[model samples]
Target: MGAGHGHRLHYHGHSRLHRAPAHLKLVALVGFMLVVVATPRELYPVFGGYALLLVAVIASTGVPFGYIGKRMVVEVPFVLFAVLMPFVATGPRTEVLGLSLSEPGLLAAWGLLAKATIGVAASLTLAATTEPLDLLRGLQRLRVPDLIVQIMAFMVRYLDVVTAEMGRMLTGMRSRGCDPRSPRHWPLLARSVGALFIRSYERGERVHLAMLSRGYDGTFRL
Candidate 1:
């Protein structure tokens, strides 16, 4: 991947975590997440310990807590699902704050929220410290298949490109008096989205042909 590819997520730090070998960091992250996942849900205090451990790691990185908090908006869907569980799930009900909610679901939601939050925080921390290219190299070192790594590399590289394309298309739509945000314009928005997909697909094909012409044989250097 290019130097610019994953720089947005990286905080450009000089801490030990920043200098740690990418493969080692990857292994440590997976191990930490596994331990968090395997812990019994009823052992709520253990999750507090896990959260503190992550907090220590985050503090060492010198990345702002608010920065991590802002990036955590991606986990809102998980939060919403967890919030609904107590009401929607089937179980014996209990009262809290003058509301009846499923007892089992309350526990399940707590467990789900804790795990999901920690997982997102850990992954974001990793991204904040490590470059995309280093992560790919780490994957290769771990014997992850070259083809899979290459696909990941390309996906990272193209995310910005695809996003820019979508932005331009949206701009064009607004220029033509089709407001994508308006309910009546949804059909136009959907068609534009379809067009964007076709354009992206064609761009991928052209990229593949270019790579092939340059002696790529189903794989190239990462």
Candidate 2:
């Protein structure tokens, strides 16, 4: 639609990775992730191989390390969950550094962390090289259902709009002396979230009606 509308994650580049067809990149990502997921956790050396492969891809793409690192913060929550697995999992115990831990949990945690990190890194690399609209086009070309593709497209297109709306709502709250960090303002913050959801839902309904009026026919013209 717009020049920069669907290029938020795309880095301007003339590298071979950037020039590769979007559908091919999508297939490569899926195949690589599938292999990573299928590998056994106990195969530590294999995991190392996956890491090295991703490193080579990153090096080839010419995406800055700092940009990838910053985007990777989104995976921190999953990492934290994996970190707790060793402490909470019940299984055979092992001693390490003077502390007893579940052996299976340790292996599981390592697998989770390794697979997750590699997957996110690969995804980030793909997004950096391909525009958002190109991703949708790739999915369509790959025979994904039209309805699912359109849903994903709309979600990506309006994410910025929803985020900006939430920002403005928070600004309004702040101007009225509401401090979200204070416990007393927790309810206000919760209400704001609910209000934002309702507004977004109503907006979606309006957009749907407008689309129907224009003969959208439940499919995007690519």
Candidate 3:
């Protein structure tokens, strides 16, 4: 369904980045992000270099800028929260564009912005290049907590099923002449959402049970 949520889950044709081992990519990304997160806030040039590296990676992938921009919107909440550090963080106030800005806040914001962007970019790039299954294998090989890897594996596998189920529920409601926009229908719509949540919860429980019965453990050998 073309990554119905607007996230690019599929990769395009042959590229050197795509051919790289997933563990190597993951390690490189983690190391790069560590540098970004560890750099002093006063080092604006460091952040600039990080951004340039991200741009180069993106360019190498042949992914559209629009796709990156769209995915970055998901980071806005973190960005906004990070931006607030300047107002409330304890530090010397400095004049920037004639406005007093918190010195600590400015640094905090830079730190967060760089870390968040680099992490997201690296992650999205990885996801775009590798299949979901390969990504899971990479994580496992990297010795990511088995539980975390399992959860991620399950989530990636089931996300589409959940999305389809939700879509069907929405379709059923629409087919029944449900007017979600009507004030009178608000209660019904709310109930539908609640029911959907319940159904999803139950489905997860059942799936877990089934997995247990099938000799599933903390890790899948495959």
Candidate 4:
């Protein structure tokens, strides 16, 4: 990846966490997430401990809480699924707020929410402290497969390019009087998505050919 390709998730910092070796941080992050996942759902206190640990990590990074909070919106779909679990799951029912909810489902939902939240927060914290290139380097150092590392490297490098292309496509559609909110515009919107995919695929192919010309031999060099 080029030095110019800085990810939005990376917060510029010189703190200890930021300076920590990328592979070590990667190992720590995976271990922390694993511990969170392995803890029994009934062990609520353990979950609290995990939360506190994450808070400490976040505090050390000096990244803004607002930045993390905004990114947490990515977990909203999981939150919604957790919320519906109690209502839809079949099991022993109990009354809460004048509605019957499955007892097992409620516990399951709580566990799911807690685990997912912590996992995402940990990931966000890692991203905030580590640059995209450094992350790829870390994975490479950790003996991750070269092909997978190359894929991730390209993803990090071209994500912005692809996103900008999509934005331009959308703008062009709007300029052509396309109103995506209107039912009549659904077909056009779908076609736009298809076109975007095709364009992205072609662009990837071109990039691959260019890489090959430059002696990129199926492996990314840090």
Full-model lDDT for every candidate? 0.91, 0.89, 0.79, 0.90
Candidate 4 accuracy as lDDT: 0.90
The deviation in Å at residue 211 for candidate 1 is 1.4
* Sequence-dependent TM-score of model 3: 0.78
Summarize candidate 1's per-residue lDDT along 26-77 as a digit string, tens digits.
9999999999999999998899999999999999999998888899999999
Q: Candidates' TM-scores?
A: 0.91, 0.90, 0.78, 0.90
lDDT of 2 by residue, 98-172 (tens): 988998899899999999999999999999999888889999999999989989989998888888898889888
lDDT of 1 at 41: 92
The order of the candidates by lDDT, greatest first, is: 1, 4, 2, 3
For candidate 2, give the lDDT: 0.89
Q: Give candidate 2's TM-score.
A: 0.90
The sequence of per-residue lDDT tens digits that candidate 3 reaches over residues 150-191 is 889778877887777777887888898874777988888788
Best by TM-score: 1
RMSD (Cα, Å) of model 2: 2.4
Name the 10 consecutive residues with the lowest summed lDDT in model 1.
1-10
* Superposed Cα deviation of residue 194, candidate 4 (Å): 2.5
Per-residue lDDT value at 156 in model 3:
86
- Which residue runs of candidate 4 sit more than 4 Å off their true CA positions? 1-5, 179-190, 215-222
